[model samples]
Every structure is written in C-alpha cells, then in structure tokens.
Target: MSLRTVAVLLADQAAVFEFGVLHEVFGIDRTAQGVPAFDLRVCAEHPERPVNLLNGLSLNVPHGLEGLLGADLVAVPATELREFSPALLTALRDAHDAGAIVLSVCSGAFLLGAAGLLDGRECSAHWMNTVDLAAAYPLARVNGDVLFVDEGDIITSAGTAAGIDACLHLVRRELGATVATTIARRMVVPPQRDGGQRQFVDMPIPECTGDSLRDVLQWMSEHLETEQSVASLARRASMSERTFARRFVAEAGTTPAKWLVLQRVGRARELLEGSNLGIDQVASRSGFGSAALLRHHFTRTVGVPPSDYRRSFSRALSA
Candidate 1:
C-alpha cells in the first residue's frame, strides 16, 4: 500500500528533538516542492491529555492509541524508559500486523521491544542504549554503530540527527528521491546517508577545531577522484605517517582508510542522486576505480547497490 498517513506516538518524557524530526519530515506540507502532504497525527495514550517532555515542557496530544489503527506509518519518538501501557503496545502490534510500517527513533525502540515487535529483527538505537535494548530484548538483533536499519517494514534509527536520515530514507523509499531531496533541501540536510557509516567519527574532521588535519581533510574531499592513502594524507598534513594516522583517528573517530572509503561512498551517492553518470564513470569520479569496486563499497556503505540507488532516485524525479 502507498504511504500516506503517519501517526507519531509519544509517551511520557518524550525527547522533543526526535519528535520534531518526525514532524519536520512527515507533518509538513511541501506541495510547492511537488511533495504530497502526509496525514500526520501526534497520538498519545490519553487523548487530550498532556504528556511531559524532557525540557520540563508538556504537550497536549489530541489523539489516543486508536489514532494508530489506520496509519500507513506509525512512528514512536524517544520517551523515558518505562513500561509501555498495554493499550499502546497493542496498538503498535496491531499496526504492524495490519502491515503499517513501524519506525522508532533512539530509545523509542524500547517501546517496540516492549510490544514484542522487535523479536529476531535486526534493529538499532542510540549507542548509549543499544546495550540496554539488547539485554532487555535478547531476541532482537541490535546494531548501534550505524545511522539506522531498515528491515523492510520496521525501521529504527540512532540518536537525534540520525532520525532525519532514516525519515528521509523512508520518504525516498516510499515516495521517491524527489520528495526526499525536496524535504532535505528545505531542512538543509542530506537526503541520504549510508546507514553503515560509523555513528562517531574519531575527531569528526568536519567539526574539528584544530587546524592540524583540516587542510588535508578538505583536500581529500575535493580530490576523492584521486588515489588517497595514509602516506599521501600524512605528506599533505606535513606529519609522519604514524602521527597522521593517530591524529586522524583521534579526530575522525575512525581509521583513515575507513574514512576514505566513506568519503568516496558519499561522493558516489551525490552523483547517483543528482547526476546521470554511468556506474563506471561515477566510480571513476568517486575514486572507486571500477564499477565492481563501487558496487561493493556502495552496497556495503549505503545498504543498496549504485544502480538501484540511481533508479530509485531517478524514478522519484521523473514521477
């Protein structure tokens, strides 16, 4: 069935950021961008009841658990780790049994877990909570490192901003790239981020304050088409190879080689979504060397092959 209505469930002490992410993506009406409006509803366990928020504020949700019954997508934003009311759990399970796509952000996975919906499913949550989620829901396969995991029907995202990536992915998957890109453009965020990309970059070169590796990192991004190695990057940074490698990890939160592959994959995604380059050409431009190599890294990083990614996005634009 086509994705139309979206119901966001909020419980006690909901994290406003994750809830806002869902609202920003699914609740907004962006007809100007050729995106259809979603029937977005923020539901709580008690209709017209005030639900507390983390910031000491409260929200008066108008709908109750019944609101989830007909939703095409049911999103559970992060809430305090407490027992889910039986009504909410039943509604969630019923929504899943009825084939609605169920999604959770951060600790909201706990609600899905409580509903017994995450059993044996490959899921993810905030890194801080992954251990707890795993221990609590031993049957569920939990991965905390990636941005999000899309197991066809159920999608779970990591902390805060990763929710945006997962939501846009759902838009890109169900609606099309055009809608996702339009939403992302308005939001000033990337439409797609590889789900497998590490949650933390050692020093997070992009957010690095020190100037030590800044120049080298910028150069690498600008020249992804060229060969890059630790030795080459070290030379560019004017540091010894070992020093550069250590500093790179310290700042990037990942090894230089892994970081380089991620950069190439990111470039390939941009080319796939925005350009009409052939696989070989795209690979060459992104420094993947060959179509086979691109396919391997792209799939491993983005969770989909390049051709499939292009076709998915292209169809969105044409549609």
Candidate 2:
C-alpha cells in the first residue's frame, strides 16, 4: 500500500485541534529525518474560501473537493454536523469508493455517517458524542470506549489526542513503524498507542437537589486531601450510613468512593496545570497519598502521565 498523498477536508466551524492533528501528521516535511514527506492538501467545499473554526480563527483553504483526486488518504476533521452540501458529501463517498482510505476525527464521523460511508461499519467518536452518533447512524457500530476503530479502509477516531493516535497508527500501518515512530517523536506522542486506549471521560460534579447534600459536596471538594469515609460523612450529614450512601449516589450519579476519586483527579489536574508543584507534592495535596497512586490514576483518567499533561498545559513560571 503506497501512502503518498493526503487530503484534509475542512468545513465551517471546524475543530482547530483536530485539523492540526492531521496537519501535524502529514503536512510537515520530515525528509531530512529519513521519514517520507507526504503531498498534503487542505480541501474545503469552496476553494480559496475562509474556513471558520469554533475558536474564531479561520483558514484560507486553497482547494475544493477536486483536491481529493488521486489522494491515497482523505481525512475529515471535526466540524459542525448540520447542513453539509450534498456535493461535498458525494465527493467524500466518491473518494472512498475510488480507493482512498477515509479517516474521520471526533465529530467528523458524523460527516462520514451523513455521507453514507459509515453504514454498517464499526466506528468511534468522542465519548460525549457516541450516543448521538449511534442514534443518528443506527446501522453504525459506535464504540465509545476505544480511542479509534480501524476498518482497513475507514478509520474513525475520538477527539483531540486520539486523532494523533489514529494518524500515527495509519502511518505505522501503511508507511512502516520506523516512519511512524519518527513522526511520533517529532510530535512528542506515542508512536503506536493501542487503538483501544481509553478515551478520557469528563465527569463533572453533579448538582445536588437537597441542601444537606449540596453542603456535603462542597465540604468534600474543600477537603479532598483528607480521608473521609462513608461513616464519617454520614455522621457529618446527620444520616445513617446506608441513607448517606444512597443519597450520595442519587445526587452525584456515582458512589462516594468513585466521586471522591474523580474530585481528587480534578484537583490534581488543576495543580498540574496551574502550579509548579512537584509530583509528590501534587499527590499529597490532591489526596492520592503517594506519587505512585497519583501517577496510576492520573494516567488512567487523563490518558497521559501527569508530567506529560503538565508539559503540554502548564503555564510558564516567571523567572
């Protein structure tokens, strides 16, 4: 399989990060490092038109659907799912039918679904949107748990970093492991993450209906570093242990232990992104008790090590 050319499809309200993922993987020239350079083209429905992103930025795309001609791969980045032109959708299906491997990132799967390209195919999307994707495309098998699903010719990936994983996997599959590794090293991501790598599920704190439960939730958030069991919490809330457990789950939609862990991880993210605290200090402040435990939960919850997350998201410290 010769992988030489890539066409990235963009639409109005495109996701900048997802588009950046494809551009990072195929647009950059790495021939100096022995990795093959791809003939990457950015395609839109209207050539030389301003393609808007949700973040108020826009790209002056130079190519239209015609740009997909003769491409080895066509990548669809996340964009607004409503009201895509019939011509553009036809171009997408035609590209796939013409033997170009088609890949979608994040909500981009919806475009493929709308194009009738995802019918009866196993796919993935941002976990938050998996239900909608499955509902809209009842014939498509949507696996919300995985980072991406590779169906030989069609690849559907979850949001953001998972797009990187899928693109790197494609590089490894068609180009070679060495080339993928070279690209990954330059992107500072794992060369070959398991396509089944878990997507990060954002668990926001649920609102409590009752005053007591609301106060307890606030207290728990404020004292995340301290160890507080159901019994102690029940006493503080003036309720029986069983009643407290039931009430907690009813209010939070999760068990007390699980909610506490989520809160701790959230706090850890805040500390990692905002402060210059070391790992051990972060663990202590976030109630993980030790750095090892913090690392385990942080990696599992956030899809990256705390250190890596910090490197990418942390604010610069003043010298």
Candidate 3:
C-alpha cells in the first residue's frame, strides 16, 4: 500500500515542543512491523524564510503551503502569536475544503478558528488560552476541560503532552487499539485517556490516617453495582455531606456523582467490548439501572450508541 502524507505547517516563533510531537508521531517511519507510516514534510508559508524557533536555532523550510495539497493530514503546531497570517489561514481553509484532516496542537486551534474551520465545531486549545479563544471565536464551542476533541475530519488538542494523546486517539480511531497501543508502547506513554478528563488538577495528598476518603473511593469502585449516592457515601465515611463533597472534589478532581457515572460508563464499555451479553444484562452489571439509561449516557459520553460500539469491537475481536 502507498504511504500516507502528513504536512506540518511552520511559522515564526513556533512552539518547539508541539512541533516535536508531530514529528515523533507522524514524521518518523514506523513501518517495520507492517504499520502504515506517514510521509512527513515540514512546510512553511515562504520557502526561503528563516523560521525563528522557541530555541535559538532556526530552520529554512524548502516547501511552502503548496505542500498542504498532498497531505492526508495537516498539522498546525502552537504559536506564540494569538492571530495567524491571512495567507496561512487561506491555505488551511483550502486544504480542509479538499477533504484533508486538519489538526491543531495547543493554541493552534486559534489558527483553525481564524481560518473559519471551527465556526460550528467543538474544539479544544490550551487551558490557559481558553478565555481568549472563547472571546475571539464566539461561534466555536471551545471546551477547556478535555485533553482533546476528535471531530472526525478536524481534531484539536490542549497543551503540549495532550498533543500525544490526540494523535494516539486518532491512530486508535483510524486503525485500532492494537496499533495505537503498539505506537504508545514505543513512545512510552499511556495507551488511552478519556477526553472528558480535566487538563490539570491539583490532587491533594491524603492524610495519613485509617479514616480517609481514598479508602471510601476504593470501596465504591468495588461495589459499583450497589446504589451509590453522595449522602449515603458521606454517612458511611462518618462525615457531614458538605465536608465529604468538598474532600471528594479536592482529592478526585470531580463531583462524586459525575465520577460515579464515569466509572459506571467505563464498566459498561468493558462489558460491551469483551462479552456477548445483552444490553439489559450489561446495563444491570454496570449499574446503569436500565437499558434506556445506559443508552442515554453511553451515547452522551462515548459519542456512539452502545449497540454500535459492541458490534465494532466484537468484529475486531473476531477478526
């Protein structure tokens, strides 16, 4: 099979780390194990311009935006400038119009927004720039909490390392878990992280005591099938509901109810992927109460119906 082409757009004062991530994932040839490798090119707006990098080093890009036409995937690394050049935006718009996957790392989403690509799409950028991105592009649904957003043809990630997560996720969605896992193992990073997680959280260290909320969290995970509520858990922990809620959020980085729902949905996904159980049985085991409830939250969180996810994974396992 022919190789896929990926183009990385370079600009002045580029973010070196984000550029490195694009190079690491798509620039390198990883076809020794029959994995499809990308044909990578670093293109600039002007072929002979000296590009100033974050470090003292400079680079001269040989190809200009014309290279974007040959790319199956086009990446725009983060930049220090809040606004992008009008010419660069036009090139990106043309690439997207021709059916290429346009991706952004960190503040690169700002470029996509400036190019009018994010007008009706949900996108993510660095959490620190969330306010500015929102104010600048009121038409875009800019989510700050997630690591990334994969809108099929257009993907955007939050900060530096989140670029790795977004790329791995695209690999998984396009290839499969096996290929994504292999790539992640080679890169020495976690294979998967749900996109809904907070970009950063100040996890409080648990007090060294026999009575701690950490123990309660473990217990809750162990007994997910049972009815769990904030008041009931607080009573079992021997603390007032208000204090328990505060401590839970401080330690866990999310509300107790939201956390419980996430855990339940996670369990449901596992059962759906690994078992041939009916929807009702999967729902009961995952503590979703009923199949209707399972369908509602599963589609809301996972972005697909439970039946579809099950069928896709089941086919993969069989193959």
Instruction: Return the top candidate by TM-score.
Output: 2
Model 3 vs truth, CA RMSD: 8.7
- The parts of candidate 1 lying over 4 Å away from their true place are 201-319
- Candidate 1 collision pairs: 201-252, 201-253, 202-251, 202-252, 202-253, 203-251, 203-252, 203-253, 204-251
How would you encode candidate 1's per-residue C-alpha lDDT over 148-167 as one tens digit per residue? 99999999999999899999
- Tell how far residue 126 is off in model 1, in angstroms: 0.7
Ranking by lDDT: 2, 1, 3
TM-score against truth, every candidate: 0.65, 0.77, 0.64
Worst 10 residues of 1 by lDDT: 200-209
lDDT tens digits by residue: candidate 3, 1-319: 1227888998777899999999888877778965687878899988887788877768888789999996788898998777778899899999888878988999988888989989988999988888899999999999987889999899999999899999888878877888788888888887886666557532232332334687888888778799998899999889999999988887777888888888888888788888888999999999988999999988877666888777645643565
CA displacement after TM-score superposition, residue 307 of candidate 2 (Å)? 8.9
lDDT by residue (tens digit), candidate 2, 1-319: 7899999999788998899899989999999999997999999998766988887998898899999988999999998755688998999989988999999999999999999888989999999889999999899999998999999999999988999999999999998899999999998876777887667576575567666688888899999999989999999899999999998888778888888888999999889888999999999999999999999998877778898778766874422
Q: Candidate 1 lDDT (Cα, whole model)? A: 0.87
Q: After aligning candidate 1 to the native by TM-score, how far in Å is the CA of 272 from where it should be?
A: 24
Cα lDDT of model 2 overall? 0.89
